[model samples]
Target: MSYKTIVVHLDTSARAQARLHLAIEIAKRHGAFLQGVFAVFAPNPRSFVVMAGTAEYYEEHETVRHEEHGALERLFEAELSRAHVDGEWIDETGNADDELPKYARRADLLIIGQDDPADPESFVADHFPENMVMSAGRPVLVVPYAGSFAHIGRRVMVAWDGSREATRAVHDALPLLKQSEQTTVVTISAAHGNVPGARPPGADIAATLTRHGVKVTTLDLPAAKDVATGEMLLARIDDIGADLVVMGGYGHTRWQELILGGVTRTMLSSMTVPVLMSH
Candidate 1:
């Protein structure tokens, strides 16, 4: 019911500091071991095919990579020291989107930043945040690209669909939800009504959370055919003024070419608050 270790992805991006600060706060709160992972992809050999010289291309790329890694390491150390959190820094040479998930297996939770499309260089991978969430077996906390969140898990919103994925997300978020001042579980039901033999939407889960000492409330909304599920959830998050959102990241695609579910993709692309997702 508590995070023992937290792994955070670090990079030389504008929003990296915001993510680090949030991660530090969480680590301090839980008294967890904090780890900062910097995955620096080595120069792609394929790109040399178009260039006249391979040596020069690799030399320049290596230099930039080393410089970036050093900068990230310095920032990681400084922040951890200032926060006085038990922490470690890891530097790896590989595709960030791939390596990060591997690192996540050892940690109770993983923290990563939302991709900023306007800043192409800010992306850690081709699909970035989505790829990490889909691959990491553990829960992931994705910090927004624009906003600064000084506090998290104070107010929470859970998007429930009554699927196995939803169940996993709810359970995975138990520690945070239990600490939240208020937690709202929003269920999107079919327009018809409750399905046969199923408990009322959100009722069972809300009761369960109440037993766990969470200040829980339930809200039922009819699913709209024309609107995407992610849009509905985002609107609800705004309505409730939630600082954090917990939900399942459902998706179907080959590992090489990921195609995220509509809701998963939309939330990653247009999230206003931090989101904790479990696949």
Candidate 2:
């Protein structure tokens, strides 16, 4: 449950530096190895609109992608040298959604930049959190578009659903939770969904964590009035003054490479704190 290795998905977007800074900060704080991964989307031949005059321009633009990969490696190496942190750099060619998770499989935690919708080339445009959560089946620490995080586990909030995704997130977050100065398991539902005969049915989920030596609090939020679970979770996260929020990635497949998932899109749109998600 100790986080000694972290994989951060790097990209060539404007947000790249912010993401890099946060990852390095976390690695230093935890004494963890930083695995820097830059994902390149296989240029879509079909998506290119054939243009006679622009043919050369398009080819030149594409060439830059390759060179940019190399430049990123050099940049990260320089930065890591200054920080005195050992890290490996990788430039993987494929759909970031597919390739990033494969490399993330062995990491204690995965870090990704929260993409800006304004940027057409944002890697997060692929709805990666959904795929990463499902495929990587690990805790993902997502840095929001702006503020960076320091030591994440000092105080935390857990959004509990008792679903497999939520369960996986809890297990994946055990390392952080165990280190937290305080951890709260908050379950919001119009009605209780605990399994029958589960002890501390006041959402015994919180009690289970208490048994693990976590300074824990469980709140069965009855005001679960909102059908929008994402909003509820965010509101509660604010209430707790927690810097980190841990929850399951919730999604229902909308189409191939598309998910109209509730909480998935909600957090993507706006989140108040850093979120650690698992599918």
Candidate 3:
């Protein structure tokens, strides 16, 4: 399957442009229809004190929101038009944590910025990326908040394990993998949860990807002393000069709270490149 429809999250964050740039590139590459979903944090008027000046406070807040919304819409339109990519803009004012996933579910892929706590403009909800990865049934490509990624999916790395989540991620990333110049499937002993005994770790997946026209190879990571699997994966990506990583987003929701797996948390916080994750 291909990415026929792609949804991208847009806001006033510093990395919003970077996210949009990559999204447009991906859309152009796949000849896909892009949807730019604009959703940002807005404080509820009821949360403010019921005072004489409350009306003024509410009015000013709306005015700023409208200005920013219009600006972002203009920018999105201009970029898409210049790139010759077909797309539409969607302005959303609801809670992002609940609303973004609804849009994501209807698209073939969702592109979003990595959570940057220091960037006050990007604060929609706590653990926003984590929540989206777990909640959005589609694949989620999370762009890093600090870097400029002009392109991606050239040299790809897949974090392979034998779990259902990992299997789903591999299938979800098949389109990208087939287009990548080179793809490496790395199996970290600590991260390979319940690998099938029928064949060696990463072998079956490598063979399947090869059949799908992906330039695929497998690597079994050597045991490391006191090194976390996430750290190892990051180092390997850098060493191989990979532009993108595909992996499973391991997490579960509990009472509306997300409890991310250890490796997933580490990658979300410290990833150096874009990651395409599926749950």
Candidate 4:
């Protein structure tokens, strides 16, 4: 279970290079093809009405957009050449949240940057990472907005909850987990009721991974009062000194708005290490 193709989202953000470096490392590790995808956000024609001349203003906006696209392409090519990794570049014109998921379908894994609340304009699209995780049918690895990750998958922490999403995340991360020197499966005992085949939360999964030649350990944690489950998981990651985390992305849609589960939202907002998530 090795990644054959790795796709990464690139933009004008300063952290784009960090994300690309991480993606290149993963691609080189697994001998995978790397793809750099850049989404050019075109100006909306409706906004031209605010200007004195609608058509002329729209044309100028498009011209600037094209220039930016060309510059980004050059940057991507230079990086790829410097790394000397087998790769390709994809330039799309649209909202990143919509187009990235489409590109993700062809890759084994999708790499994206976590949104930085300090600079809302850092992302090319609104809710970019979150939307991709919800829409992409493949595993999405989100790199933190702040930090340089020189190594990944050396120590792994899996947040298991005995749910379908959690199971999918575990399976999707098998290649990485199998290669890790240490893998810990942490399950929070929060009194989930009457679920069939829910034998000791993380034991079964740990056994299954051990059968697959993974150096695995199981740790059961009790939820503390007045603390969110996601916070507990984050604390555990720090305690174990894990460089990577694998977990399920839980969310629901209400009135056309996608509302993420508390754990998923919290992790995305405050993650210090890279996280691999599947929905």
Candidate 5:
């Protein structure tokens, strides 16, 4: 199966253009319709305590935001025209955490940016990426804030643990896996244990991918109790030169991930390559 419609989140952040470029490329590759949804952090003036000049401040903020939004739409339309991509632009004014997930549900895939703590403009909402991963009801591709990725689906790494979430992620990522030059399933054996009937931890999934015409391999890594599985996966991704990573997101609740630590949370914080995640 291929992506028929892809939704991308755009904002005032510097990296938004990079995300748009990548989304256009993906749309071009898959011959899919692209939707650029402009959703940023816009706090409602009504939510604040009534004070003198509050209305004036709110009005000024909105004026600036609208101008910037228009500029971004022009850029998005220009890129779509230049690439000959079928697409549309959507202007949203609300909490990003709420609006993006709504848009994502109607698309085959959602492309978004990883949170950049150093850039205030990237703060569209609290834990935006994590929320989207859990609530989008579709696969979310998160592009790193610090890098330039001109290509994806070339070399892929799938973080496998054999849970329902992992199964869903693998299935959601099938389109890209079929196009990948090489795909590897990295299993954290000591931490997650083995799949029910597979001799090796990742054998079953690897075989399943093989059936779908994916050039696949498996790697079983033993992790100690004190070591973080996410760190291990990141190192292996670099060693293998993977450009895209597919994995389950927040197998546990967000609270559990925050308290006990989790691969999904870690990758969201420190991924070097683009990550496609599903909950």
Candidate 6:
């Protein structure tokens, strides 16, 4: 489907310009309506933790929060001023991971930065992919902090798992796939040594893409590294010099703090190109 209303999850960090640039290009490429989103805590998440602090402390917290909101808005405004495409700005004050998807569930796509969680300052896991993907069920395009993508159609990579979420990510990314000069479907081990029948039905997928007139190529490789499939995909993306990588978002969280076997977490940390994914 063509993206008409794309929502980008903007991390309010000093280096957020790269994320904004990629989002602008995607929006223009699809002629899509776009919105820049920043997650915030409503009633403040810190209120629960900092209750015992002095009045002066709470005032400082509130001031800092207000300034953050303002800074985010201005940053986006500046980016949009340089962007050839036009879009709206959005800010939601609440627990970031919770607030984003809860309000913008039906958006055509979600774009966010892919930064490491261990850096003590990465936005990838720190923001809210876990909650957003599980709830929104919309594709998320994750870009590494050192972004360098301009247009996404030169060469494309699709990481296929044949699961429901993977299926969703692929279909959601079809618009870009169709526009790509070449597209490769890279699937991790389907058997996993456990289920001989675990592989995705391939001929049907090839037929489906053929119907779209997509220049599609398919390869199912054995799991080679200790790295998760998502990480493998991004590694291949860089190796292939791909402009865009498409894959399914695997895994979900129970409650708020726990996560399961999703490859998204790893991909986000190390990716260097633009990636399109759906939950």
Q: Write the per-residue lDDT of candidate 1 for residues 62-167, one digit (tens) a residue.
A: 7786787788788878988887899999876678877888889988999998888786447666777887788889999999888879889999999987777778
All candidates: TM-score: 0.90, 0.83, 0.92, 0.88, 0.90, 0.78
Candidate 3 wrongly placed segments (more than 4 Å): 50-62, 193-200
- Per-residue lDDT tens digits of candidate 3, residues 15-103? 88889899999999999999999999877777677777987878886788678778878989999999999999998878998999999
Tell me which residue pairs clash in candidate 3.
Answer: none
The lDDT, on a scale of 0 to 1, for candidate 3 is 0.89
Question: In candidate 6, what are the lDDT values of residues 107-151, reduced to their tens digit?
Answer: 788876665444333443443555566667677776666646656
Off by over 4 Å in 1: 45-65, 191-200
Candidate 5 local lDDT, 1-279, one digit each (tens): 998899999998889999999999999989999999988887768875478788888898779878877899999999999999999998787777777888889899999999998988898877788888888999999999998998899999999988888899999999899999999999877777555455888899999999999999988887867778998999898888999999988643555343223788889999999999998
What TM-score quantifies how close candidate 1 is to the native fold?
0.90
For each of the candidates, the C-alpha root-mean-square deviation to the true structure, in angstroms, is 2.7, 3.3, 2.6, 3.2, 2.9, 4.2
Q: Is candidate 2 or candidate 5 better by TM-score?
A: 5
Total clashes in model 5, counting residue pairs 3 or more apart in sequence or in different chains: 0
Off by over 4 Å in 2: 45-49, 59-71, 191-203, 224-227, 252-261
lDDT of candidate 2 at residue 94, scale 0 to 100? 69
State how far residue 186 of model 4 sits from its true place (Å). 0.5
Clashing pairs in 1: none
Report the C-alpha displacement of residue 192, candidate 3, in angstroms: 3.5
In model 2, the Cα lDDT at residue 116 comes to: 69
Q: What digit string (tens of lDDT, one per residue) describes model 2 on residues 1-279?
A: 577889998877766766787788778767889999888455565556675656566688678866776777888898888888888988666678877877788888899867667765455436665567667756788877766565577889988777787788888888778878999888764544654335433357676777777888877665455357777777777678898888888765545755646776787678867888887
Q: Which structure among the candidates has the greatest TM-score?
A: 3
* Whole-model alpha-carbon lDDT for candidate 5: 0.89
Better of 1 and 2 by TM-score: 1
Model 5, residue 169: distance off in Å is: 0.7
Please, what are the lDDT tens digits per residue for candidate 4 over residues 1-279? 899999998876667767888898888788888999986445578877777888796787567656756776787778677767788998766778787888899889999999877753365766777888889999999999887797799999999988889999999999899999999999877734324446668888999999999999888877677999999999999899899999999986688798999999999999999999999
Query: What is the number of backbone collisions in each predicted candidate, taken in the order shown?
Result: 0, 0, 0, 0, 0, 9
Instruction: Please tell me which model should have the higher TM-score, number 1 or number 3.
Output: 3
